[model samples]
Target: SQQGEEDPQALSIQEGENATMNCSYKTSINNLQWYRQNSGRGLVHLILIRSNEREKHSGRLRVTLDTSKKSSSLLITASRAADTASYFCATDGLNNNAGNMLTFGGGTRLMVKP
Candidate 1:
């Protein structure tokens, strides 16, 4: 069953602002991943944080995970117009099989004005 849930259904920001998004899940997860999609097109993988890790960063993206709370958050620093897109958080169960199943959240629409 899908367990990921994203917050702030929608967000609007300026060219150089910071944007924060949140996600919550309902079950144990091996890892949580964040992705960005522009105009309903292909999704761009942003960052992935393992359940054992507290926080991770990649360039302008920051991700934090709290297994106890079954939640995660993604932060975008110095946002740009290109950052305008739909954001989603996905979680993979703790199954150690070669085939992994990913459950994605509803998604958050972000609009960054130029």
Candidate 2:
């Protein structure tokens, strides 16, 4: 079963604006990873935040995880047309029974208008 699910299935923003997306998951996780996929392309690794970590950042991307609420949010600052893509959240179960397996969410499609 899928562990993570992203909200606001779609988002639209203008270039230079900030875009935010949220994800919620069930069960405990070892780590959560965010990924970006352009239309007709492979998924690009974004950032990963461990269960002990509350927040993480990489370049223009900011991610916050709240295990208490079983939710996480990703913020993209200074958005550009190139930032337009589908964002997904993947989580690895704490049990580790599946080894390195990860469950992915449906993802949110973002459109950045120039």
Candidate 3:
């Protein structure tokens, strides 16, 4: 399957804590990206790490990729109420006919407590 799947569909954490989510896929990809969607807003790109890369960091966000295992993970440090949102992992499939397009996973809903 080309779809990515995430674990722990939901997570709750106190403010200032950290939250982590895992994703797995069943196909070869050129890259993987992490995105965040606020309550009613569209998805916002968080980070994109190529298949050759094993780890990447952006501000308070950290992403790790294990291509051999077809899995990736996202970690958000210093959680806040504003950080409450749905997180999704998208993969860039390797296709000759189709250019790069993001394929999103189910997603993980994060809730930050005050």
Best by TM-score: 2
lDDT head-to-head 1 vs 2, winner: 2
**Could you tell me how far off, in angstroms, the CA of residue 89 lies in candidate 1 after the best superposition?**
0.4
Model 3: lDDT equals 0.91
The candidate with the higher lDDT, 2 or 3, is: 2
Q: Relative to the unseen true structure, what is the C-alpha lDDT of residue 31 in candidate 3, on a scale of 0 to 100?
A: 95
Q: After superposition, how far is residue 61 of candidate 2 from its true place, in Å?
A: 0.3
Please name the candidate that would achieve the greatest lDDT relative to the true structure: 2
Which rank order by TM-score, best down to worst? 2, 3, 1
Candidate 2 positional error at 4, Å: 0.6
Error of 3 at 81 (Å): 1.2
TM-score of each: 0.93, 0.96, 0.94
Instruction: List model 3 lDDT by residue over 88-107, tens digit each.
Output: 99988886258687788989
Q: Assess each prediction's global lDDT (C-alpha) against the native.
A: 0.91, 0.95, 0.91
